[model samples]
Target: MKTPETLLLNQEQIKSLITMKEVVEIVDRTSKDLGVGKTINPTKVLLDLGETAAYPPYSGFMNAMPAYIGWEDSAGIKWAGGFLGERKALGFPYITAMILLIDPKLGFFRAAMDGAYITNMRTGAQTASALKYLVNKKKIKLGLYGAGMQGHTQTEAISVLFDIDELRVYDVNRQASEKFAQDMKDVVKGKIIIADKPEDAAQGDVIVCVTQSKDKFLKNEWIKPGTVVFPMGSYQECDDEFILSADKIIVDCIGQVLHRGALRGLVEEKKLSEKNITCTIGEMAAGLKEERIQKNERILCLPIGTGAMDVAVATAVYNKAVEKSIGVKFAFV
Candidate 1:
């Protein structure tokens, strides 16, 4: 098959092409497919992502996660992660990533789209889908950790799906936290507060953690018995206590989480047992598991993050860009 024109869609174009509803729908279906046992290989792409005083000015790396769909997707689209930066960087994003949809027949590349916005939306959308399956929509007091892109993205989706009236947020950088509060206040028309500590925000009806801190954000005591905790921040964001305390635990993929995700810390320390974990967010989202159980059940949702999400979101962007002719077309034979 001849390769079609390679469209280059920038961030703005991609942004206009998608809406929260579409993303939500994609997430719902993707989660269900995942729950039904779809195989997606999401390879960990890492480059020394840490600010170093040494050579290369700012020594860092951009991790690229490439994922290929198997069984569920006959399109053979492979999505990858885009991140550029190192830890403790002054003003550089840790990851500068993108996704490439390929034609499996001849290994032809279909499209290359902006990844920063793509990554944030997919991750946030995944979390929201988890909330749909794990949290009580009636109770919507949300506490968010880290006022970064991921923080706002998650909040944006949450505001639409749940009747979230108030969001309590905190960040090491006071400005980032304050900015997030103000910006989200503008976007959601909901109540917003700046938190002094992670614990202060813990009591929210739905607490979403989005920081990149290595240290644990919330204590087990901080986690309410019946609250929904969505940890979207650190790779190992939650403390053992909070992780272990949840009546039900959900991951995007146990294989992914066990390797380098929010649950790795607990899994490594032996604080959380394998039996304590119930299902992946996709599995729960897929309807394989009943959505939001008894009010008192402790539900913790950790979107292990998957390639299917990237492919789904990217596909959305690609179709939109094509429809609007927003992207540049490239021809490479």
Candidate 2:
């Protein structure tokens, strides 16, 4: 019985489509099933914009990802493609994306969504999940660098699993830093202090660098011992010393890392081998391995971005939406 599926939900209906709780559950379940791995082929495709000033240098790029996700009992190929880079200059956004959900059985179009939040939160929450296991359970402060796209919600995601005493925020864009601090104070329920320099913010129990800097804005010396640093914004910024110095290099999926994530740069630089990666965060969460070996140490957690997570969140949201008939059913399939 291959009946046409004509369910079409608009942004208004899907705006509150995903939640933090759903995102965490996706991380937990995905960890249980896949054990933190994905098949990723990374590449850069150029674009042609028939306009002047060229708002964004790149547009219409695609990342091909085919994944075997366990918890969902579904295998999928979710494509991350769009004209995102140019959106920012048009006063829109930096990343504009859509998640294609397939019906593992029939190979039908189940749903497509604005994956902006899905991409941001899942990656951020994966870092938070690593922190939940890696960071010492001491009530300490947090420092966030480049408090934009991925930084703001990361604060909230970390708060869900741990208690943060205070937050220090820094960004080259002063307004972003100030706004992030104010918002964090209200939401994180902790004191928010703005940092004057990158070094100032790095001095914390946990330091998260979520910037767009191509260079190493965060110096290795600035990293304190036993600090959990998440330099998720750019690749290779942490450098050889930082990689070698980190007692533990935890990642969401080593496959993605090696393919083209944080660890790829380390490997290209000959700083790390396959064995150098301490372990996937899933192993620690699942009790297959341990985290934070000693009190005086530093660890790095990086999640490149996984479709299994996107599917996990989309599944949860879809289920809830179906329960209440929240989405609109269409006649055209």
Candidate 3:
């Protein structure tokens, strides 16, 4: 037998092979597969790389996220790293990583590709998938925090779903928010307003927080009735009360949510648990569980990112790359 070849793809190659609309559809399909138990997706495993001789104090961390999707016959692990302090100085994004795809049947490494583009696009697409099943409104006012890459993609993905009358953008760095508004001016059909305060961004029909802050900045009272809040960060961007007091709470994975993100602290405090979770977003999308029983019900969506999502999207990108004869392929022992 000949040695198997593994494909190597860069960020630019992957970027050329996928789009947000395609990713949203892929996420929708993958969520259903996940919901019906056709996938194996575990909670993220974290590695805290604390201060080292060469790195600064409280330097950075990495997460190992692995999963398998039976329907697509895809398997992979995403090694996601976050080194904001060092990366900023190096002029790199805070989070950077790669995805490794395996031949599920043979258990051979098949491909290694840039994951940052996939991460940003899929994160936004995941939110869009959740909104597809959770929201009923045709138009909305969106309040967004963390005017960064995530903020830009979230708006892009959401703009595909509803008519936005206004997009309220907020960031602790005033320049970032202003830049976001200016950058998105032509892309976003709705008027973009840079909010002076986090609270100012909170008063909206749909609220999304994607900041890097570990501190709880979003107040519970700022959230209105009949709103859906998507907290897309790894830590508590919103107050614990915001999650505990919501009418419904859905996540990418119950185990993952409990282990990290907005729900972790609450779980540790015994204020929340698996029982408090209404269902996975996959369940809602798959129609296995009901969503949005009442318009006035406040819903919280915590999607910390999933390997299943990565595998599914990555698989698509890989297939496209192969069909179009993109990327470099070479044997590795």
Candidate 4:
């Protein structure tokens, strides 16, 4: 009998192993797997731990996301937690997570690695992948809301696919947006502007909101024709009018969106359903549905960030690690 061992990788190790472009490719393939029904992804189970007098003085939430990418023969689960207070007090990241990759055939754990990088990359990659079907232009004015970690990744990933002629960024903290512009100027080929208001940023050809704000900030009036919008957060960052009035609404997963996140409120209010969505990004990627049929159509892309992507990326990384003899491996049983 062969002894089993599981590879353990830290954030730095994993970062060295993969690139954002690689993650985008993995995410695009995972979407295709999802479209072809080769993926098993359960709705994320969230544990809302209200403000507790714990190590961090913040209302925190944790999510258990389990998924299987049958096409890749990969299975894994991501455990992620978010504590907003840590950012304000300790200057710590708001989100932290880990992923466990399992051997599907043998049902044995293969690797354990940091999930934060994967999480960030996949989130941005979702938008980039979806945009491949949504946008047809080469040069675009990109609008970004929330100038934080997500903002950076979203810009980085999108810059890989399209030439951002202009990047207008907005944040509640003006300094953060300024910092974002300064940091991303080299990445964005054209220009970086700090928007004075959310609406200013919303005027881009491609608009994305990655904020945690519960209150709606994006208005339908601010949106222009032929624009693709990505509301990447759980809450209602965009008003009901904007979500409902869009020419087409596409999501990563209809069930995941309805169960929780961006469009949940509309579902709960009996205003939206799976039928209302035009098609998933995956479906479009797989050629099962049409995307960007009209040049002037307004599109809304809700990518809730699926675990199948994590599984796919993690599995690929694990295989590479084994091939290159990277990371530490410990005996199992």
Best model per TM-score: 3
1 or 3, greater by lDDT: 3
- Compared with the true structure, all predictions reach lDDT values of 0.70, 0.68, 0.87, 0.87
lDDT of 1 by residue, 223-246 (tens): 766787777754667777767667
Output the TM-score of candidate 2. 0.87
Across 1-333, the per-residue lDDT of candidate 3 in tens digits comes to 676899999999998999999999898899999889998898888887752225436577788999998788989999986776666788889778899999988888888999989989999989888888887786778999999999999988887777788999889999999889988887677899889877999977789999888789989999889889998987888887878789998888988888788898889999898999988988988899978736678999888899889888999999999999999997887
Candidate 4 overall Cα lDDT vs. reference? 0.87
- Give the residue spans of candidate 3 off by over 4 A: 51-58
By TM-score: ranked, best first: 3, 4, 2, 1
Please provide, for model 2 over 177-273, each residue's C-alpha lDDT reduced to its tens digit, 9 standing for 90 to 100: 8877766776676678888877788777888877656576777888878788787753455656777888888877666677454566668777677
lDDT of 1: 0.70
- Give the true-structure RMSD of model 1: 3.3
277 Cα displacement, candidate 1 (Å) = 1.7
**79, model 3: CA deviation in Å?**
0.7
Q: What local lDDT score does residue 256 receive in model 3, on the 0 to 100 scale?
A: 86
Which residue runs does candidate 1 get wrong by more than 4 Å?
A: 42-64, 68-90, 271-273, 291-293
Model 4 TM-score, all chains together: 0.95
TM-scores for every candidate against the unseen true structure = 0.86, 0.87, 0.96, 0.95
